[model samples]
Target: MDLQAVVDSLPRYGEPLLTTIVVTVASAAFALVVAFALGLMTSSKHLAIRTPARAFVEFIRGSSAVVQLFWFAFAMPVLLGIQFDYLIAAGIIALGLNYGAYSSEVVRGAIAAVPKGQLEAATALNLTPLQKMRLVVLPQAWPEMIPSLCAFAIMLLKASALVSIIGVMDITALAGLIGSQAGQDRLVHYSVVLVMYFILAWLIWTGMRALERKAKRGLGVDVKPVKGRLAPEVAAGGVR
Candidate 1:
């Protein structure tokens, strides 16, 4: 193996790894939308709303993500006779649907955790159910939801690696290619993949922390840093 060739090939992986980040972020955005919609629906008092939301969440949650990814990427386009970008559509939908189902419970729990008195206050103010959720409940529930959503975002980043299995040339896929070229340097090539993953995950965590702080702002809570990261408890309701 030419040492110079190995060093030079590393930079080539950068673009592919960046795709991993883009896919994760896009998937998370899609998933969050699904989560909030299903979560709120599941929490609805009416059976008409709650039953379908519960069914959607349960079906997605119970299904295997690997199979889902393959189905959307490989089988769906063929089965449905629809043309689409297999890599993008499949990764986004699979990640969104799978994690969206898992995180819906988190969103539901956070919204439900809002003080009952606040709900009463909204009712007294003659606010519509939609207005109540938009203006009052969500504002309070958002802070509590941040930490859990951040965790799910990190999980999404890791799960995005699975895209390689479906022929998406993400970081892991690049690493496989790099290993093939580098011969006995497979250890080094894959080790770099580990570092890439850690850095991506850490970036996700840091961005979420910033969003967490912003979410806390409405509560007038000042977050104290702990071990170089703000404590979620402080951001939640620890203000004096």
Candidate 2:
């Protein structure tokens, strides 16, 4: 492995790295919103609301994510008679739709796992449905949802590489370009790319861990920093 090739490729990665970061951030934000909306709809008392949300979740989850990207980038333009200038928006939509479907289940399960007694108490207090969710349910459920949502966010970051196929020049695409030209140093180039992805995922995980701790603290739960990490079972919501 020629370390020199890896060093040479690093400088050219700056622009592509920015593109990757933008796509990941935008897609994750979109996915989070979509996840919460669909998750909440799935729990609605109205069969009319729950049925379509559940169906969309299952449909997106069952299909291939790469195929979805292709549909947005290629098929949609042909069908709609519109062409995207950069293809960034289409990639973000594809990633958001794919991961959001999966993350919605995490949200649904977390919301459902909240103590039934709390729901009854909220009802007895004569709280409106929106108030019940905002003041009672979401505050409890959001913390429980964090870990799974973190996992999905990291998956979305790695999956952002899929956009390279549609010609968006993200880090992975640039790394592939470097590898092809580096002859015997292909291994070195790709090894660097692998490490770059790991670092990005690690950063996202660390951020989410902090968020979990903050959410627990908001509920007055004991949140001791255990060796630079949150203590296990902090989700149990043990009071200080």
Candidate 3:
């Protein structure tokens, strides 16, 4: 808990932490793209598109991510007769697919929250489906979606800890290594790891809160000025 000890500990885990951040960011980006496409498909008018997309999302969400990671890391190579580095393949396949399903729900919800009036207006404008979605719907939907997306990103970051199970050497794995090195002080080392994890989670939460506030203000929902003006409107209306 001494400042110097914490600093020294960080250096030992620095490389693994960097790897964890890189993998999480890359996989989450891929997941976001996949989720957007699949979620759109799930909401498609065509049963042909929607059913399969729904099925895929359900399958990914229902199964254990740890099992999926193992399958991708081990069974995939044997099945395809291709070798992949453990960390790279696990990060790409498992984290990407798992988060993709969750992000799909976020996408679906955001799309649904787009006002029906806007859709009707788009129709009146004679916009094609794609044009309406791209120009009108998505632009509006994105702001509503930002908070959920940030939450999903943070969840994905925590989930990346599971990649260490498949030999990826993420933060959790590095923590385990450090704990082992500390021997009888394993409990202390792991306590430090817990603190690190808590700090990381807190940072993510704080960042998301800031984003939520920014989005609210950008959407004209921040109430400070509105509250100040309310008394005058009430007095003018003779309600007070």
Off by over 4 Å in 3: 1-7, 182-184, 210-240
Better by TM-score, candidate 3 or 2: 2
TM-score for all models, in order of appearance: 0.90, 0.90, 0.84
Relative to the unseen true structure, what is the C-alpha lDDT of residue 77 in candidate 3, on a scale of 0 to 100?
Answer: 81
- Local accuracy of candidate 2 as per-residue lDDT tens digits, 46-89: 99999999999999999999899999999989999867777999
- Estimate the Cα RMSD of every predicted model relative to the unseen true structure: 4.7, 4.5, 3.1
Summarize candidate 1's per-residue lDDT along 1-240 as a digit string, tens digits: 666667877888878887888889899999999999999999999999999999989999888999999888878878996656557777888999999999999999999999999999999999999999999999999989989998999899989999888888998888877788634377777888899889888988898889889889768976754477656777687976
Q: Once model 2 is optimally superposed onto the true structure by TM-score, how far is the C-alpha of residue 148 displaced, in angstroms?
A: 0.4
> Which regions in candidate 1 have their CA more than 4 angstroms from the true location?
182-184, 225-240
Please state the error at residue 199 of candidate 3 in Å.
Answer: 3.0
Note the Cα lDDT for every prediction shown.
Answer: 0.88, 0.90, 0.78
Worst 10 residues of 2 by lDDT: 230-239
